[model samples]
Target: MIEFLNPAELPRARAAGALVAGILRTLRGRCAVGTNLRDVDRWAQAMITEAGAQSCYVDYEPSFGRGPFGHYICTSVNDAVLHGRPYDYTLADGDLLTLDLAVAKGGVVADSAVSFIVGGSNPPESVAMISATERALSAGIAAAGPGARIGDISHAIGSVLRDAGYPINTEFGGHGVGSTMHQDPHVPNTGRPGRGYTLRPGLLLALEPWVMADTATLVTDADGWTLRSATGCRTAHSEHTIAITDGGAEILTLPPA
Candidate 1:
């Protein structure tokens, strides 16, 4: 279902967004070549508890997934992209890592994701892929505003990724989010503008633009959660939750300094 935030709940939404952002920033900083993905999940659990917040993932059980996602954060590495369930794996140098997080505070929820390289040995291809997702995310955000159509935002995002010569995967993209991590008004990576749901003020959207380095096809891992590129190529994802306002969209998730 598509859920919009009330004026009274805006502040709480902002707070939840901030917490999600801060957690992502902290996890990114602490992630290293030798860091274990499971340990990172543990750290996220501790931080969420300390902040008096709730994890949107840990007990989440959806038909798309094999079972409940028993983790606090999604730790996707290299070819993995969406729903990357954390496991016992150590990061390696030059590994493209993606961290997706969502949390609720004061009954409001915010979701966001980021992709980065492990260690200092950043491969040129990996760097370019990460940059493309970021650019697409920015383009999608720029296209969002009151009265705008959801297709407009999707078109903006797809234009960037496709123009970059990367295949677009529409299986998973952005979505409406407010009190829950995932909501209605599904936003695909590519689409025609002037179509889909009409944007309205007070609507909160998580605009994520993600892509695989080569093929658009995806293969599920043995864990039945992590989505890896079909060709085993690298992947990257970028996301943010924004609230529609009077003039334009306001980004809710900004990491604290």
Candidate 2:
């Protein structure tokens, strides 16, 4: 279902976005070499509860994932990309980690994700991959605004990833996010410009650009939640929740500095 947030509801959306962004920033700061994945999840849960917000992930029973994800945040490590459930694993040096989070406040939802290197031994390849996704996400945000087509955002994001020499996966990408975590108007990473749904004011979207280092194929982990690279190549993901307004797109999930 595609949802359009009225002007009054936009404020609530911004609050939800801010809460999730703050939660993600705290989790990112705590993630270091030897940090347990479960610890990150616990931190997220505590923060969400403290903020009086509802987790969009825990108890989320999606068709593609195992019922009731039962986690407050997604802890994707190294090759893992999406739906990465927290487990008993310590982050190692040079390990690339991705954290995707969504939360609802005042009945409005916002979603975002970030990727970073775990320790000082940052692998050049991993850093490069992370940079590519961040660049692509920026481009996608730049192209999103009222009267723009969804394909324009997709093309902007895809161009950066393709030029950076990473394969694009269309199976899972950005989508409409408001009042719920995932919604209609599936936004792929690559598409023809001037195609797809026209953007309108009061619409909320979560634009995410993610890519694998080597291949486009993905393999699900035994837990039936984490999606890893088919060849175990490192991956990175970047995202932001934005609201379409009269002037342009306003990013709602940037963390407090």
Candidate 3:
């Protein structure tokens, strides 16, 4: 289902976005070598409760997943990319970590993700992969606005990842997000411009651009939730929830300035 927030409801969307962003920022600061993935999930739960926000993932039971996601946050490390279920693993130096979070506050929801290196060890390949996703995200956001086609955003994102020498995967990509965590108007990472749904004011979209180091293929972990690169190569993902507006799109998931 495609959902749109009226002007009066935009503030609530902003609130949800801010809460998600703040939680991610806090988690990123606390993450380091030897930190357990379960600990990350616990931290997210506490912060969400303290902020009076509901986790959009805790009860998420989409068909693609094994069952209800019983975690507060997605902790993807190194090869793991999307739907990374928190498990018993301690982070290591130079491990690329991706935190994807979504929460609801005041009846509105926002989703966002960020990938970064865990500790003092910053591998060049991992750093470059993360940078590519971030740049692709920015390009996708820049292409979104009133009158813009969803394909425009996809094309903009795909161009960057392709130029970075990374293969694009359309199996899972960005999507409409509003009252719920996921919605209609599926936004692929790559597509032709001037196609797909036309942008309109009040529409909320979660634009994410993710890529594996070598392959576009993904393999599901034994846990049935974590998605990893088929080649075991490192991966990176970046995302933001933006609200389409009269002149342009407003990014609601940016951290506090």
Top candidate by TM-score: 3
Q: What C-alpha RMSD separates each model from the true structure?
A: 0.8, 0.8, 0.6
RMSD of 3: 0.6
Error of 3 at 76 (Å): 0.5
lDDT, residue 92, model 1: 90
Error of 2 at 123 (Å): 1.2
1-257 per-residue lDDT for model 2 (tens digits): 88898898888988998898888888888999999999999999899999989999999998998779999999999889999999999999888899999999999899999999888986889889899999999999999999999999999999999999999999999999888889988999998889999999999999999999999999999998899999988899999999999899999999976
Which 10-residue window in model 2 sums to the lowest lDDT?
118-127
What global local distance difference test value does model 1 have? 0.93
Predictions in order: lDDT = 0.93, 0.92, 0.95
Off by over 4 Å in 3: none
lDDT of 1 by residue, 1-257 (tens): 88877778789988999999998999999999899999999999999999999999988998989999989999999989999998989999988899999998998889999999999997899899899999999999999998999999999999999999999989898999877888989999999999999999889999999999889999999998999999999999999999998879999997886
For model 3, residues 84-186, the per-residue Cα lDDT tens digits are 9999999998989999999999988899999999889878999899999999999999999999999999999999999999999999999999888889899
Clashes of each: 0, 0, 0
**Per-prediction TM-score to the true structure, in the order listed:** 0.98, 0.98, 0.99
lDDT of 2: 0.92
